[model samples]
Target: MPDQHSTLRAQRRAETQRLIQAHAVRLFTERGYDATTVTDVAEAAGVSPMTVYRHFPTKEDLVLIDRHGALVAERIAASPAERPLVGRIGGALIDSVAALTGGGHGDDLTADERFLLARLQLMISTPALRAKHLDNHYALQQAIVDALGDDATDPDAAFHVRAAASACLAALHTALVRWAEDDGRTELPELVTKALAAAFGERIVDTPR
Candidate 1:
């Protein structure tokens, strides 16, 4: 019963955050990211400014909030332990990218993909957001390193794992930036696989057509 209640609370919190972020994105789109205020987003979301602040402490957070790290971690956990570390991490990243873009091609984007595209465009155009986006990249790198657990404990292993994680993430980032630049006209999963192949010398994983 307690577990169920805790799960319900978490679900409600996530829903509130999603609602607030949706309002923030709409206001940012309509009023320009620089012109929109948190209070305005709060009012539009029908929540107090405090609630918005609780979920997203910084204005940049409103645009940059994402579950990429969690997604990557989940994929890594599901990967076979016997696989090479770099391959596991690289494949996990490709799978996560496929999931993000819904493995579809061209301009037919889902609602979530459209929202993500809008966020990516804002991050690309806004200096502060771009800086924060790089910081988020580091955070994601750390998440991948953490996922390696005991495998990264040795000094050499740690260095290799960190380097590999950074490289794979760079590949994923390149793919995402290209997808946003092309206005979602290219299949994102294919771009991710291609980027990883260019960096790693072969496809990390087979992306479904």
Candidate 2:
């Protein structure tokens, strides 16, 4: 079973975040990302502008977060012990895409398939959102560390876990971005599948399992 607390936290986070993104994206699409103010989105979402600041400290965070990040965090957290680590990650990415596109694992990327793709493009085009995206990658990796077993007898082993987690996340991000450029107009599964293979292949080949 999934950790209810984690699932609830992620649900709340994505709900608040998606609400913010939906509004911000509308404003940005209408007035442009650079032209629109945080106040604009806050007004649209019906929250006080300051309440908007609380949920999104920076305007860019509104663009940076979407349903996908929260889903990825939750999927990895819920993965079972019997699942291969790389398999868990690849599965999580696929699940996150389902949350994004309302589809299955092998579906190719959908171009602005919905507001989700638009939000993704917005983040890519904006430098601030790009940086927040990087921060999120590391944050998710930390959450993965906690999930794996925080009770480490060997401190060095913990560091190794974090390092491996970071590398895996970095690859996922790179693969996703490249997939975006293809605009979901090209073969999407190949890009992500290759990334999955690269990430888990090295470790799997060396491990006994």
The whole-model lDDT of each prediction reads 0.85, 0.66
Clashes of each: 0, 0
User: What's model 1's overall lDDT?
Assistant: 0.85
Q: Over the stretch 27-56, how does candidate 1's per-residue lDDT look in tens digits? A: 887788999999999999999999999999
lDDT of 2 by residue, 1-209 (tens): 47998999889866776687788987886787889998889888887888788888888777765445567768767766576665665666655655556332225434335465566667788777777777777777766666667422368867776776676676667767775665554344445556766767745423332
What residue runs in model 1 are displaced by over 4 Å at the alpha carbon? 206-209
Q: Model 2, which residues run further than 4 Å from truth?
A: 1-17, 67-70, 77-84, 104-113, 150-153, 186-190, 199-209
Choose the strongest candidate by lDDT.
1
In candidate 1 the C-alpha lDDT for residue 22 amounts to 88
lDDT of 2 at 62: 78
- How big is the positional error of residue 181 in model 2, measured in Å on the Cα after superposition? 1.6
lDDT score for candidate 2 against the true structure = 0.66
lDDT of 2 at 149: 71
Question: Distance from true position, residue 169, model 2, in Å?
Answer: 1.3
